[model samples]
Target: MEIDRLTVRFGELTAVHDLTLNSDCGEVLALLGPNGAGKTTTVETLEGFLSPTSGTVRVAGHDPVADHDLVMARLGVMLQSCRLYSAITPLEALRLFASYYRRALDPAPLLERVGLTHRRAIAWRKLSGGEQQRLALALALVGRPDVVILDEPTSGLDVEGRLLVRRIVAELRQSGTCVLLTSHELSEVEKMADRVAIIDGGRLRAVGTPAELAAADRRPEIRFSAPAHLDRAALASHLDATVTQPEPGRFILALEPTPAAIAELTVWLAERNIALSDLSTGVASLEDVFLRLTGEHQPEAKGPGQTP
Candidate 1:
């Protein structure tokens, strides 16, 4: 899938601003941003749910808007809100949806893969939130689509539900399905995404692998046991490090890039004969990078049909 200069506008507001991105076959591209960042608009435009005000969206070499039917045949979508008849059983729903496609996977095994086989005979509305989400995912995959667009597939899910979705995405990748997913859960993206795009205010801020983003924002931190009344200012002045208090009796020192921060920290502590405990070092995470790039505030979560 390729989106070049895609733009979507609603009256005076532009939801997506000249966004360009691509997803390779069998790759998972994560759209990371807070609510109202145009991630949903971008995905919806690519899936043919909405036409772009300007620019082009191509899925599987076909334009989504111009070739709606042809593109729909090759694509599957799992949006945040999906409704199923309350009276229909899980198997029944899958079979009904499967009938619309030229080719589809068997409903029984597909239900099993999504961990809904036990509930295959149960009513759709009787399933839990997580179960309903899983059924929606199964419906999306039943057609064996070449491209899958998942929007908040794990929203409101428990830990187990999140794990199930992650496993299903991995299986989809193994089967050579290109996936474009939007998610607020950093850990989920970190685990499953091949590349991540940070979108804010309807614009792309950064695009790279998880490791690359982390490395780019790398900062070393030091932890040690100190007196409860230890003068943070004095310690910082002495070592020339920025100090942060994460908790009572716990301090983190951010060091400069001259040398290994840990090495310098160790020497500074040794010179003062200060005993350190639970000392560790590591790189920044996607969440850190996101916060640094988008600022600490989270955008308001908008409901469907609301203009971004």
Candidate 2:
């Protein structure tokens, strides 16, 4: 999929401005942003739901709008607000959509993969929100599409449900399927995404691997504990870095983790006759980059490997 110099305008407000992005087969390209960041608009344009105000958007080398039928056949979209028959059972719904395609996966295996085998006969209205989301995922894959667009697939899911989706994403990547994932889960994006794109206020902010984006505007962080509280004003005069104290005797310094920098810090601390402990140095994380670029506070991760 390719979006070259694309822009979307709603009257006088520009929802997207000169945005260009792409996703290669066998790769997961994660689109991340704060609210009202034009992520949905960009995805909808590629899905052929809305026409672009300017520039080009294509899927599988075909114009999404001009060749809607061809693109529709190759793409599977799992939208957040996907409408379904509340009275239909999971098994019945999967089979129903399978019949619409020339080739489709068997409904039985899909039900098992999504962990909905026990609820196969339960009506949509009887299932919980997470269960409904899983059914929607199965419906999207029933057609065996080449490109899958998932918007907040893990939203409202329990621990087991979230793991199931992560496994499915890895499986899709191994099968050489292009997956466009959009979610607020930065930690999950860190683990699964091959490339990350961050946008804010309808403009592209940064794009790269998680590590690359983290290093874009960051310094290595040096965190240490001291025997006593260091004077913040005097420390500023001795170090060429930004310092923060979250605790009485703990200090975090933002600077390059080079040999010279470490030597300077050690020498300075020794001259002051202060004992340092728990010293560590590392670069920023994807969440750190997200916070810096989008100017938003980082929320706590849902769990160790689960993301929402």
TM-score of each: 0.81, 0.81
In candidate 2, residue 282 scores what lDDT?
A: 75
Please list the C-alpha lDDT of all candidates, in the order they appear: 0.83, 0.84
Q: Can you write out model 2's per-residue Cα lDDT over 50-79, one digit (the tens) per residue? A: 999999999988899999989988888899
Using TM-score, give the best candidate's number: 1
Task: State the lDDT at 123 in candidate 2.
Answer: 88
For candidate 2, the 10 contiguous residues with the lowest summed lDDT are 298-307
Off by over 4 Å in 2: 223-280, 297-308
lDDT of 1 at 204: 90
In model 1, pairs of residues that clash are: none
State the local distance difference test value for candidate 1.
0.83
Candidate 1 Cα deviation (angstroms), residue 173: 1.3
**Which lDDT tens digits does candidate 1 get at residues 88-130?**
9999999998998999999999999888899999998899888
Q: Which candidate is the best by lDDT?
A: 2
